[model samples]
Target: MDLVNSFLNFVVPPASLLMLAFSWPTLSFINVCEWIYDTYFREIDMDNKVAVITGASSGIGEQIAYEYAKRGANLVLVARRDTRLRGIAENARRLGSRNVLIMAADVVKEDDCRRFITEAINFYGRVDHLVNTASLGHTFFFEEATDPSVFPILLDINFWGNIYPTYVALPYLRQTKGRIVVNASVENWLPLPRMSLYAAAKAALINFYETLRFEVKDNVGITIATHGWIGTEMARGRFMVEEGAEMQWKEEREVHVTGGPVEEFAKLIVDGACRGNAYVKYPSWYDVFFVFRVFAPNILYWTLQMLSTNHVVRRTSYIGTGRPLYLEGSPPRKFLTAGPSTQVPVQQQLKME
Candidate 1:
């Protein structure tokens, strides 16, 4: 058995490389065909369909809600901030969503997830799409954690926060042959510094949904979106810091947030979900790095290290400097407290009840 195993191992790598080389052109042609069909021919009517989006208060999630609304989809926006959700719901109504329900609930807790899913079913009668966009970002090195207790919340929010809702919504999604849109990160595969836990959690998320896709098959479609840096609060350095730690990195904002706008990313995500795509990546150029990671990992690691070493040595993060960080005019808070400006009148608010 050992001899056979060794023989297979010796043959597999070269054989796999040969197969890949032979198949590359065919695969590329097939992908181009699929892209063409999805772009010009295929269309999934979202008019009046229900889409439930978590982390809908801000960032990519918030923009996705708006994009869905523009497609005439009814929206269920969930977050811990009811005020922000309310404001977003108003804008969604104006954007052409016939109904917009706002629910304030923490995604980390199983009970909260179940409650919101139940409420969404009751309000919409069906959930055609479950978009899991709830996540937290971490910008400190793993070893620099002053409070190790905070580590679990990172996993809980990034992994379980997306899982619990999917678990509860899967049956309903199956009934409608619906789709699940995940807002993951490129850090899942890209070795970015100061994001050890965040990257690990995102990697778990990508794997979970990929496996789930096989089990569910055609009954439910899963669109795993791995995005690069976008202009979100997280990119603005709003990360989960230890107790009394803050994030004040005004000078570094440009360095961290340089990517496509959140609005463009959201539009692409919604379009891909409607087309039943398996994966969507923003700044799609990031896909190139995956080849480097697979074929030449040491090179990838060295390149990333070289690029990040200067920033790492600066030690401006919360754990590095041991000082509260916030933009000069902004409050010293980690989360978004103020709601977005509502252009629609209060009377125009959509009430599910």
Candidate 2:
């Protein structure tokens, strides 16, 4: 592994630079032409199309369902919450969906995922799009993690959760020449502090789908949605904090959080997916970091470490239940100590991804 790392470290820089130097102009030109052609000559008609969207009960998933419904798509909405699914299905129908089916199944379970896909196919006869939006997030220091199993559990939900439904839906997607839309995060490449496991899972998801795209090229379209922090239950979910030797969930109390509106972000994702675009990066500002990480990783590392320190300082006390708690307030109260607080101002932020 050391040898492999050393080789990668030695070869990656020049290879990256060469690729950028060699491919940028041609790729940019091709993209321009494609955009012009698509803008003038083509549009994806979602009317009467079938779309299976996991995590559709709330947040971005919920908004995506609304967008598709307004465009006249039939939808199969999947989530663990039966009540929420039923509510969203009603909203989808009101928004102009021809048909809306709700499946209350956890995406992490293979049997549940298989059943959901089978039911979707049985109901719709064909599926034109599969949106793998199911995901999990965690925020805690890796070394201080209380349970060793937390990491694998995170992977099982975030990585494998997306994979299972895609596998079950692939045959139907192939038959329809359908598209796959995956909601992966920017943390996949960024690896922010207090989010190591979440980053690992998303990184795996991005790479897995990228490989799948190449393997199934031209047969099926795949859109990898690389989103930054968006307003969502998953984003505002409690973060784990290290207290002495143990980890505990903390109530996040920061205001003026840096993220886009979920509805707009969802619309962008759906638009990109419908166009068969390869990637959809929201806010677009995050692309700067993606490029910065590639070219100046050491600098990005130091910056993230600084942000993590601020995060630890600003965090409040623990609330054990892993549940959603939304609190509205001014900035967090400062510590009573003499030294300067590691907490940065609201403008300079520490965010969850």
lDDT by residue (1-353, candidate 1, tens digit) is 99999999788867877898999999999989999999988868999999999988877888999999999999999987688788899999999999999888878778998898899899889999999988877666666555554567678888998999999999999999999999998998998877888889999999999999899999999999988877775665543333233211122222344546889988999999998888898888898898788766899999888888755663434432223333233445343211233222111000000
Top-TM-score candidate index: 1
Estimate the TM-score of every prediction.
Answer: 0.84, 0.78
The segments of candidate 2 whose C-alpha lies over 4 angstroms from its true place after superposition are 1-30, 238-258, 310-353
Model 2 residue 340 CA deviation (Å) reads 33
- Candidate 2: worst 10 consecutive residues by lDDT? 316-325
Candidate 1 global Cα RMSD = 8.3
